[model samples]
Target chain A: MSLDKHAMAELIANDIPRGAYVNLGIGQPTLVADHLPADSGVVLHTENGMLNMGPAATGDQIDPDLMNAGKIPVTELPGSSYFHHADSFAMMRGGHLDVCVLGAFQVSAAGDLANWHTGEPEAIPAVGGAMDLAIGAKSVFVMMTLFAKDGSAKLVEKCSYPLTGVGCVDRVYTDHATFLITPDGVVVRETFGISFDELAARVPVKLLAPAR
Target chain B: MSATICDSAAEAVAGIEDGSTILVGGFGMAGMPVELVDALIEQGAKDLTVVSNNAGNGDTGLAALLAKGRVRKMVCSFPRQSDSWVFDGLYRAGKIELDLVPQGNLAERMRAAGAGIGAFFCPTGAGTSLAEGKEVREIDGRTYVLEYPIRGDVALIGAHVSDRMGNLVYRKTARNFGPVMATAAKLVIAQVSEVVDTGRLDPEAIVTPSIYVDRVVAV
Candidate 1:
């Protein structure tokens, strides 16, 4: 069956192994938290300062003390514990995370990542913790739009935007297609309904399809 | 008629002046003191120094101040890179000075000030460039780093609800900076969505007591 971005995200989340620690990047990637399997035991790690956090609360039934790095109020599972901020980043940069799902402005076929800044002289230069997660996670997954608003492919041979992490991204999930980066080239995992070559043509680099 | 607080945004922010240093309570996007921020934006106060964990995104939070060229300095740890028009403009124009504090130290510094603890030391930034020029003290054959107190002239905070007597409760992430900075500021103004009767809130739920708050406004 053909899967759109939402469906693809849900499918990928369903496959996450039980008890795996995962970090959800901002934007569309943040939406995956809504689809975690009820019967599973996956734990969500928020960069702000939450672990084993539940989904957002509906009303006044909120705890102000529990929030993500973004200051968004979040729920705490029974086992959740709060610690020093550096300890949280230590877990991230020390290679303790199992997987990380991040949103990307651009990803290279060679597994490079560039999602932090746009290099606009008039833009804020806050890198936050992207560089830490991209290099620290055991495996990296990128979620983004298949193409930019200007009709250029965000999945390219090399990123033009400043790089966040070099040759680190392993899986690519997008609105129109999903692929895996390989030593040979960009290998098609599942294009869902879109044509592989059609999306590849938009990319600035050479494309090589995986052997079926 | 019983006494009432300012009835308009203008009156709400009339006390704020140019070149004032303010501490705001919020993690990043959560529990931001929206009403007071809106009032400040509307009041158009300029050349302000803001201390917070994150610079609110463009058109929101502290970012709104940057958008208006009202901010003269920023003391924060995180500011998103995706959108940058407001913050970048202020930085590039040399109108803003940035002080990047480690998250824990920032929170602790405010807490220490609020608690009237003049200064404290920790090993958080020790052996790193973050420790540059800071006093280093050793005790019991161990090294500890010294960090100074950072208090604000005023603290602008958001609460889920507050009582008539000024006890405060914050929702989830909104609780991050509010309670700590409440006591640290000379004047604390809480902007809440609802105002309740005294003793209406659970004793355990009160994050900031009436003593720390000078004023409360229903958003």
Candidate 2:
């Protein structure tokens, strides 16, 4: 069976180093905060001028003022600090973040990311912080499904959708497999519920064998 | 003390005319200046341009302004949240225009305007369609797109408290864009929950100093 969203989050969480300052993009990538180990020492940053953000708040704990870029209520940990919007973006665009996890509409074999818009006329071009996080984070980890709902591969030879950043994604964690993107080529690190050969057959691009 | 207090929200935004560019402070509903926005609507200013993080959360505030067809254009980062139906409907019908900026770039452009910088290069949106029509330069072997500063004709902001002199304090994350918007606008009108004496506010607690504020209306 293909891994669900939570399983995909857990898989992505495995790669986050301790004490890393991370930004969780809207949607599935935000789930990574829930699965992070308590001792991981990860400091969550929100683009709207908050640092040390905790998991999503629920029920009575929800504070309308305490929300992420997605406009969802969230809790704050001790030592949380708020600043002006400019200073917050300075942290993201200035290469201060250790890693940022983002959801992708498409990722290319060469590590290009396209998550902002589908280029549809009806689609609202809400770029948000994706372009900043995609290029600003020291390492960008894209969490998404291997295939779209239409059974088409999201990992492609070239991204058909508008790009958020070029040659920025370092790794991709999908329901079917985890791929490491290096300058040389795409490398399959591991697979779930399928063999390397099966995963290779499903994808459009050539996948290189992992270095032993 | 400076007498920056306005008797009403209408008085605070009285001079805003058609085609004026307004910098609205908030992220979602957190720090929105509802009274000031309502006054702008009641003022019946048409063909206005708004700069904010999001278009609007629901049927009130900025959305109401858009619904009334007061806004001709929106410059924002995220304009497609679930409650942003007004913008979506107008944009689809070609009634309103949209200039989508990356969140960080949006914030930096405002800051650059406030800080008196003409133009600066940013690494965000370097290789994307957003970079189109902008100057591109390679810095330290990396590409950066040049973005100009963004200033506004007026700014409507919300704060927790404001002293008579207009020194403002914000509640938690509600301060999102208020501080920066205050500096970038020609006339800064702040909606505060309460008004206090100048000496009553702690020097360190003030987020936006009185120098940048032009008017204050307690809602």
Candidate 3:
């Protein structure tokens, strides 16, 4: 069976190196924080201006002034520090972040990312920090299903949607399997419930099979 | 020169000319200067350009200002949110112009403006529509797009406390753009929960020095 969102998040959380400064994008990526071990030493970076972000705040702990990038109230950990927007993004674009996990609409064989906009004429576009994380993080990971709701492959040879960053994605974790983007091309790292051949057939890009 | 202690929000926000580019500080409602914005609306500054993180939420604060057709353009990174209906309506109806910039660039541009930088080449938006037609050059073997500063005629900021010197301190994430915006504008106005006597607030703890602030209003 394919991995559920929880399982996928856990897999990503377990792979993170200890003491890695990570920024998990909003939505499904935010759940990765849940599976991180208590002593993982992982520092969470919120684009809205926080570091060492803690779990969700409740009751007396909740402060309107302290929230995650997703605008949800969050607590501050022991090493937490607050800065202004410029300093916050400098941590991103200045090569200070070790990893950033993002959600995507499509990822290309060349590791281009497209998630911010669908290119719809009437749709309101909101890019946020997607492009910064895409280009800045030392290693950029993506967590999303292999296919869209229309049953189309999201791992395409070329992105049909507008791109967030060009040649930026490092690893892609999908329900079917985990794929690693390399200078050569996209390669299968491991399979979940699907076979390498079947995954290759389903994805439009000619994926490099894993070395057994 | 020292910052003047204003008696009211309207007084702090006064003298902002029409069609001015204003920097409104906040990451949503967290650090929004609602009192100053309310005053700006009442002060009737139209054809304005607003730079902030999110456009507006619900029907209060910045949204209310936008609803009155006071904004001519919005220079922001993200404008679409669940309750950003006011900005959405104006954008869809072509009542306002939207300059969608990457969040990092949004901050850096303003930082550049305040720092007196000519312009800087950035890697964040390279090879994307946001960098389209802009000057792209290879620096240190990596592609970079030239981005310019985003200055403001006035900056409206919200902080937790302010002393008579106009030195300010903010609370947690509420400090998002306040300190930076304070420097990037010609005039900086801050609305604080309360005011204190000079030298009462520890100078070392002040996030924004009095040099960058023009007015301090206690709401």
Clash counts per candidate, in order, are: 4, 0, 0
lDDT string for model 3 (B140-196, tens) is 889999999999999999999999989999999999989889989999999999999
List per-prediction Cα lDDT, in the order shown. 0.73, 0.91, 0.93
Better of 1 and 3 by DockQ: 3
Show where candidate 2 strays beyond 4 Å. B1-3
Instruction: Please report how far candidate 3 places residue A71 from its true position, in Å.
Output: 0.6
lDDT of 2 by residue, B1-219 (tens): 453799999898897989999999999999989899999999888899999999987899999999999888999999999989888999989999999999889889999999999999899998899999899999899998999999999999999999999999998788899999999988899999999988999999899999999999999
- Superior candidate under lDDT, 1 versus 3: 3
Alpha-carbon error at B12 in model 3, in Å? 0.7
Candidate 1 per-residue lDDT, tens place, A149-169, comes to 998889887788877776788
Q: Write the per-residue lDDT of candidate 1 for residues B140-186, one digit (tens) a residue.
A: 75455798888898888877888888888776445666777787888
Best by lDDT: 3
Q: Model 1 Cα displacement at A148 (Å)? A: 1.4
Give the clashing residue pairs of candidate 3, or none.
Answer: none
lDDT score at residue B145, model 3, on the 0-100 scale: 95
- Cα deviation in Å at residue B116, candidate 2? 0.6
